[model samples]
Target: MSLVRVAVIGIGNMGAAHARTLVAGEVPGAELVAVCDVRQEMESWVSSNLPASVTYWQDAEQMMSSGTIDAVIIATPHYDHPEKAIQAFRDGLHVMIEKPAGVYTKQVRKMNEAAAASGKVFSMMYNQRTNPLYIKLRDLIASGELGEIRRTNWIITNWYRSQSYYDSGGWRATWAGEGGGVLINQDPHQLDLWQWTIGMMPVRMRAFCSFGKYRNIEVEDDVTAYVEYENGATGVFVTTTGEAPGTNRFEVNGDRGKIVIEDGQLTFWRLREPEPEFNQRFTGGFGQPECWKCEVPISGVETGHPGLIRNWIDAILNGTPLIAPGEEGIHGLTLSNAMLLSTWTDNWVDLPIDEDLFYEHLQQRIASSNTKKDKAGSSSQPADLSQTFK
Candidate 1:
């Protein structure tokens, strides 16, 4: 286990990028031994882009059983993530799965169970956790600097995708293919970070989701969800893949202070006296707690995908703790699925969502979903995904 041999399954846009990073020796103690994809066309592409020593396989089982890799990076579709990771774990291989875990919690729970039994290193591609700003925000909250959280709001609408983007892949926005729209594909990082920094999951959620509002797809393109925590704290999450010049502002207000993160800058308003304390003792109705607005200084770059992969490799080689465990991925997916379920049922969904009901509703959507037919001379060309990482 000195040099962990790795194989990447699914050589799509993101998978190919992970393969390239491994081939370029970007992760120390990680060796790219093989790559797997069902499409035979990718064989030549891997041969041209990666090293000659890198082997290619069209079958995942063959690649896993070839004894060439000690680990596998599952970068497949939303549905295949759980199945592939389970297979890799059963085969005694470490796994680093791409985000959202899976479409639902029922399946992701099984994958986590298998990983727990296999005693293998399991990590998720929650690269946003590596961002220094978020890291600092998490620290501030955990340290109780922002006393008890009152409310949290995040307006993340920067995930703009055109109709052509939806037409690029057959599974782009379909219920049967990619599961859900922006929530599953584009906003998993933010969704994960939302709960991660806040350090709590909502006890109940009510959401309004607009399906195909901006695109000709079957899933939601716009969504607004209201959540309530056990401590009586509330939150509003608003997102859409439609608006241009979109906003990505996150604000959290607490009894002692308030923190706002936007445009790579973090601003904190410190109250000289706690809001609750000031409110209780103040005699004047017009008086409020005095505050000092300060810009929090953050160092280092926002290490994206590469940093996450490096940490995963280090977790395997040096027993370093994972930034995002594969098991915790279910929390974010729970929130996403709950939102969709709330819209589907037209009711507030309770926490630890009813997996059976959610799965049934999802199945109904898949049953009635219209498959997108590919038009002639409109083949999907891989876009430069580097621009999409935030």
Candidate 2:
């Protein structure tokens, strides 16, 4: 099989992982053509560990213009996704960007428009859908066995990040740098899952968020949001980076029964048969509701981030459908912006994220945000498997 030439922008922790996967050939039909980063030493740092065949550049525009790449992965800071990936589009390369599509909805829209104009496969790094347990749960819901999803709630306080974690990089936990906190970073997975599972976006939302309670960042470190869907289904999303050993639980209650996913496992107590309301011809006060008798075990192909990279390469090379399209990324970003705007203004923020008003507010926050970089320029990388993967 022919390999797809791949180039990557941003040589931070996650970007390095993407490049290594391509170099090791774990992502079938993918080759690491080049790497780029803003840091002057980042190119050499990546070159030292990669095969000598792979090129390196300090500027993405220069690297893409060098006519050596087929597709590009944009993994830079929050605001850079639009400009860099749009440039990639202009260079006739397919693009895969990280989450939020930059901190503002307008930027995401602009990128989406560019993707439309280029007619190339445009994707986002929403890797959570690849997780097997969540996919299985989505299946159960789609089967109509869940029976009218009434309420969905998630308390994702398990993402307890220390001050050091926030201070580890310059483009982290600041409005100017990263935009928002838990909701923007740690909770994007949950937010994506929320919309993906429900198959709908909220009509309106009201939220309350805490700014810099536990970390030394300039944006929110905690958030509580209430959302209402078009079908009248309601949801509560509570997330925080401040709480230690908190809770990571998703409770989905329907007219039929309830399903819970916690600690990386999915458990559903399916009713033995149908509930009493289905055969409600007679009085229903004489007996209790029937219940199911088995625990569903979830299994998925453990590809981590490489799965997404492989999918994008296949889409660009062989005309496979994209797993996470650029348009879907905007929904979560709009929801997030609405939540933040609601909290900041002390009132409910309506749906579709009043783009102009929200942008104005975000500009103020970003302008005033002080990005305090950590002395430690990097975080520990995940164990490399190039020896085995190769």
Candidate 3:
């Protein structure tokens, strides 16, 4: 495979950015053969910005069949992800789906099934996994240096959304357009981080979520969750869009002191080399615990999604291993679904969320939502929406 023919669906901010990267030749062995979106105007934009040979369409099906495209990048709204990816797979095209795999688990699982049946490369855009720091954290945790991890907390409050940010797209905050708030748009990193770092799934979950607390949105603007893993390791997650000058900190504690990643820095507190028999001989209250910051050797490439994107392209063209396989895409989404279910049920929901029930509940939410400007021909008078909460 000399080059992978690519079609980018959805020409929104991220989609357009991806198109630019391909057009600029950031992805070698990758060519922007076509671009698609429901909006007809997007075709013209791609025509002007992308390669002259690249075709543009308002229909994804036509683009897939007509262009002889070998791969697709689905950047559509969250709810539309599964259907588009499934179609691409059926057409025998490899896929690189944008974050969260799917807003829901059943959809992501369907994609995995499609990929298996088609025997094509399937990858998710969990580019954060390529980050050097996260890669290092994963290695450290797996090394058991953290020793029987006891507690973990990640208060990702740095995701601050403004009125203009919400107003930028009608699909931005509504239930029908997107599935959820901070969990969907802002916390893909944290959600992926949760699974990657803990290396396990929750046995139970309870979450309290708020809608329109700081701003007027149909879905949650804030959420605090409690999670219990099967091994009895507990985690508390807090995220909100209302805070200014917020924090991004992940703390993991175990029998072996702790490791903290805060504000672009990583720190580890190593408990004194090993418990001495003499310490026990000294009696209970006579001695105190002591520790030092361990100088652990750093590992992994200093990189982010660009590195992941490069890998995705290479894996399809050159048969390299994917950093984020399509099979694992469902975990983060399942975690998100369980959190949403916990909030909805007001109980500690168990692992493996009932998909049929989740989709049904989600359907009802989509029906009741007031976000009028869905990409699928829904209209929103921005001025009218501007005063919707005012």
In order of appearance, the predictions have TM-scores of 0.95, 0.91, 0.91
Q: Scored by CA lDDT, what does every candidate get?
A: 0.87, 0.78, 0.78
Report how far residue 48 has shifted in candidate 1, in Å. 0.7
Tens-digit lDDT track of model 3 for 1-390 = 798988888776667767778888888888888877776666566667777898878778877767478998887777667788888888889888777677788878888898899889988888778767777777788988777777889899988888787876777788877788888878886888877875777888898888788897888889899988877889999999999989899998877678888877788897764334335656666575578887666667655655666788899878899988877878888877888888787777888888887888888888888764355311121212224320
Model 2 collision count: 0
For model 1, the run of ten residues with the poorest summed lDDT: 372-381
Indicate the residue-level lDDT of 308 in model 1: 89
CA shift of 330, model 2, Å:
1.2
lDDT of 1 at 185: 85
Give per-residue CA lDDT, model 2, range 292-333, as digits (tens).
Answer: 745877776755578888888888778888778877888888
- Residue-level lDDT of model 1, residues 282-314, one tens digit each, is 999688899999777787787788888899899
**Which segments of model 3 are wrong by more than 4 Å?**
273-282, 286-288, 297-302, 372-390
Model 3: residue 77 alpha-carbon error in angstroms: 0.7
TM-score of 3: 0.91
Backbone clashes per model, in order?
0, 0, 0
Report model 1's TM-score to 2 decimal places.
0.95
Pairs that collide, model 1: none
